[model samples]
Target: MINTGKQAQLAQLKDSNAQLLKRLTARESRLNRIGMGIDAASQEAFEAFADGINGIAQGVEKTLRNERDAEAEKLTNEATAARRSSTHTSSDTAIADIMQDVKGCIEEQYLAAEKNLQVLASILGFFVDVDAVLAGCISVKDTQIFIRRSILAELSAFDCIFAAYNKIPNGSQIAVQTAHSRNGVPRDYVEDHYTQRTTKGGLLISEACIIHDEAHGMDHAPGIYTDEQISKWKTIVDAVHARGGLFFNQIIALGRVADPNFLDAQLKGPSNDVYRDREVKEMSVDDIHRFVQHFKQAAVNAMHGASFDGVEIHGANGYLIDQFIQKQTNKRTDEYSAETLKLPKEILDAVVQAIGASKTGVRMSPFSAWQGMRGDYDPVDQFEPWVRHIVSTYKDLAYVHFVDPLAGSSQEDFRKSDYLKKIVRDAGITVVSNSDLTLEMANERASKYGEAVAFGKLFISNPDLPARARNGWPLNEDYDRTSFYGGTEKGYTDYPFYK
Candidate 1:
């Protein structure tokens, strides 16, 4: 049943916003004369904002003008859409809950918009009344309902699946399920996988691409080391760009994680650690310098040769860098063990020096024991100084990608990433979190904590995640955990978008 009182309130709010848009548009002619020091982009953005509000008002007016029966049908459809976004919600407050999501987003965007408005208006060499300018606008509470009833969760898609990398080749020509599995470089499939999940301004981080031949831990995983590999990857990246998505290649060196099955004498790490019966040759100082150069060159391969938007240093999840940071593994007495940050700083410096800070990012899972990063390892205590160093040293770097607790870890398991997030926040830098996240939780993090939330599994199943979320389309729940890793199209590109 429709809430008649709420419906009436929405109608009034719609009319108020319409008037507000009218007032805003009335100042358009002044853009030519005394527009002050506002840049062209700001003026255009304000106009677009007015246009958006006007469109919403126009939509509401058309719906409200319908007959009572039609109005009921519209309300039913709208509420049903909201229900689909939160499939778990079965209460009467679904609409109210949806408003909270929008209100959170509105507060963030409004404050930013407000700052720009004040900054531009105050530079006029005279007193300018911002309130008088937006006087016809509806109340915040009412506006939240208005916007929620229109646009839902389409804020950002910042997920990175470990399977987000390119596929395996026919190792030893083994027979496979799909023919796509047999061929090396599933270019079309890889492109489709990424392109399907992409939305304008949304970020998609690729699977850990190998930095060098010996850096690989698994068979047939993608690498950014060669010209052919870079060329093939460029096709995938170009497809993502064509769909208005931002693509980043997360580069990694497996270190001791390389198994005896895949790597030969080339296996290397900071210490002579044995992983899965594979002996890791202790990397000499010169060897360490070579890996640094490899990362720098891989970054160059990613951004320049492959045309990727950026490169993410895979410093977490027990990779080469994490191995060096681990106290149990880094048993060196030389300058390499000066601090736990020696290898990381060298690699970060080399990559940033090669590609520039704006195009480089780093991910750290200090609390995660995913790759032997266990101990009395206090994430805040151990990683805080490194985070501080990053903030002071690499100004204007892309972002610090932090992982929340891995699956099955409690909030206090290794300590929440809230402290690390605060460190990044205090530095006024962008902090992105990629892990298991729902739309509502993601919105809370992105809006409240200023962390860009990235969904991994949800994105694997929902390619049009942003659109499906906004319109409240049902998500596909048919996922195979076995097929979650590098495999055929069973759980890959074959997952259909919302029709």
Candidate 2:
């Protein structure tokens, strides 16, 4: 006569209604208290509220258990009555069918309640003090405590370490960087580099990505201008994709970093400053516009025709982009002066405009004095405005890669500025930390600071670095320093994978 399943559902509905009333009342109270300040609510009251919610859950479980018992008794009585009558088989079948239906009803009701609870959670999350709401409904704090305890109990507990490349795409937590493989490449050469790296034990994987070494738009270094170069890049991209790896092209304008004597054209820099014994002539606004277009064109070629997944604007290592970013190199009185980050910003914006910001990345070395790009002012103070602007403008970029000053200089004086780490982290962008990072240091920084560590020398030598780190295999220590800058296959792909 009385259906216990429907009764249980009624009881649950009533409980949900009461809980909603209590939650709303508590929210009002909490809101009023929060108006006074966060500390207005006593810890005891918070704990008591949490206990009350727990009690409500326990009461629900008890009520459900009692209803289930009643349903079992009712079914047994019906079967007994059927047995006493002449139609036992018919009655038993009817009771079994009803029981199945009741079970289905209960399950559906439970799912409905779960959905309602989720809706409540999402609503509560809108408030700043949802932690208080959560603490009431919140096993989250408890769960975190449990995790900490469990980690302490375990001998091998570790924090998450992300691979810099995967962090950008939000893929698997492993990455490899294209650092000093070769300065330039021909069509076949590019393909060979990708093939060697993306092979079974090589750096590139479906989970990993590759950043092609800087293409300075100079002689032999590779440029995205021509159809042949575009075709070659497409070949490399397809190869990497076939092997399950993404490829990114890094493009640069060398500025004073390029040798005047070596270049077919005149050397250009931000100011008419002599660098490396070469008299660097000042770049006109037209040159600046042309260079920005160069970056945009490179991005277009890379993403549009070349089939590359993304492009990282080379704004670091004292190149043209870096040259404009610092006061030391940029001496112009125009809008594109050292006081303005117009050049680097424009280059990044142009590239982002060419290939959407999601696929555009930029690398900067605010603290690096390499290639004579250091400014006269304190790096931290001098670069704050530019860093702030970058963070504000291109917040959603694929990543903002940084090369630490520590990579270049070991002087304690150079390490004093904390601005390098703070800049991108404050911007809340995906970061690729570069410059002489070892496997352990990379893991530590990636875990602690939420960064993706980019390895230069190590990735060059250890093709199976992720595997080596994962499996606790010893890394190859010796890499030919002589073959680091420019080389053939000997140092590039000849390094043996861990057996």
Candidate 3:
């Protein structure tokens, strides 16, 4: 931040900063401050972080340079002599130990000062002469690692990753699990889990909820059809709303994929097919008509009864709607089988009619082979028309979330969602791209395609994921995969937050 018009002044400033950094890697460095300094925390860089430091006075610069050089030189000479002594530890080991301390300071606690645009934007592109500053303490390679674990790596990587899209929101998704209580009622702790992840102005899509009793997919999973179900869900919706967040419940019907003994009702799909050794009755035209009505009523129940901001039609992951859309699942010779998209489109029309286009969204996985589902024709040939049709028909559809081929199936090899990037953007609908996206990948997708990316597994352990990403905090990596499904609050709500 020390400004200079001439090369001599700039070189002098970098040298001064290098000396200061060397002092920080010593045994006596402090961690309880906003910026690096050997003594009590200095306001120099923080002021640069606040208002720009356009230029430095020559006399002050000279004084700082001389003091830092003398101190750093003395420390290095003493450290070298100690390394040669049999009674003392090697200087390299000591320096490495101290660097670890500094690294922890950056990773776990450096962002403790405050998080705001004025501060972040100013520091977004900060740089240092890495080799010169960290020369004696660590090698060039290790210095880069230290920087990557620092605040500069987080914000500087993308100048406006958050700033450009502050008003538009991105968020995490809660996948359905069998952890709730009996009768499909959401547990208070589960509701509390959602509340912990909710940030003001962020989007949250709930775990898949059954649309009706016949749509039951898993044991103890929540539903939106019944009075008790809606009331319980309202508790969660109110909490999310209070945090200024938008909550959408994903509504699904398992159809032939449902566990036959558990549904206690007839399993219906486009054909009488065997799934996981259980046979299902082929849906009649009348039966298809009824499920359409069921989906429509469920959407109404979500928005009106439960107060969800919208409903994401679960036409993905080889569920009921997805079954109808895929060629392998819909084998009927009746009118219902003539067009595979008919059932899903009818359901979409009903939901849009009830909830309006702006409050409706759809999630699909045309490339998924989960539950024995795959696309008609080629995968792209099969789903491109469907994507085009949906965006064209429902212009204001809230979003179309797609599980990338890589995340959804094994047979897809390394397929990319390249075909989808433009269609969703051209329609002006927000595209919520999901799957195993790291922080870097999410920012790339967001900038390239104007997407609102969603994270699932990462949020399982890091409850305050948005805050972590905002201030360059490391994500907690100790999630219990065993406890991710049906478990107590240990792995559910006890994940630690970085302070």
- Candidate 3 per-residue lDDT over residues 189-232, each given as its tens digit: 76777788776545678888888877764655577888877888
Put down candidate 2 lDDT per residue, 1-499, tens digits, no spaces. 4556656655664565466457545644533332211122333333444444445455445545654675677668777887799455554565566557656555554454444444433322211223333334533221110010011001111221122221111111112223322223243543544554553212231111112222232323555666655776677778866764546677767887775432555777888988878787888888778777877887887788877766777777787878888887888888988887888878888888878775776777877767776745677765667667776887556666777767557565345434555666655555566666667776776555555555556655776665677788998879777765444555655678897
Candidate 3 residue 199 Cα shift, in angstroms, is: 0.2
Ten-residue stretch with the least lDDT total in model 1 = 144-153
For every candidate in turn, the CA RMSD to the true structure comes to 16.7, 11.5, 16.9
Tell how far residue 188 is off in model 1, in angstroms.
3.3
Best by TM-score: 1
Our tally of clashes for model 2 stands at 2
Cα deviation at 243, candidate 1, in Å, is: 1.4
Candidate 1 local lDDT, 1-499, one digit each (tens): 4446547755775677666656444434422222112346545655555555455445444443433444455467767876788544344354555445444544454454455445543332112234543344332112210010111111222222122433332221222444322112334466668887776545678877888866765665677887767888898898877765667898988888886455544788888777767677889998888899999999999999999877999888778887787675777878887265788899999998998786777888877776567566666666777788887887657778877776567777434577777777666556777666667677677656545566677777777776776777887766666777655666777777887
Listed in order, each prediction's TM-score against the native is: 0.66, 0.60, 0.63
User: What are the Cα lDDT values of the candidates?
Assistant: 0.64, 0.56, 0.61
Which candidate should be chosen as best, given lDDT against the real structure?
A: 1
Candidate 1 off by > 4 Å: 1-186, 338-340, 413-415
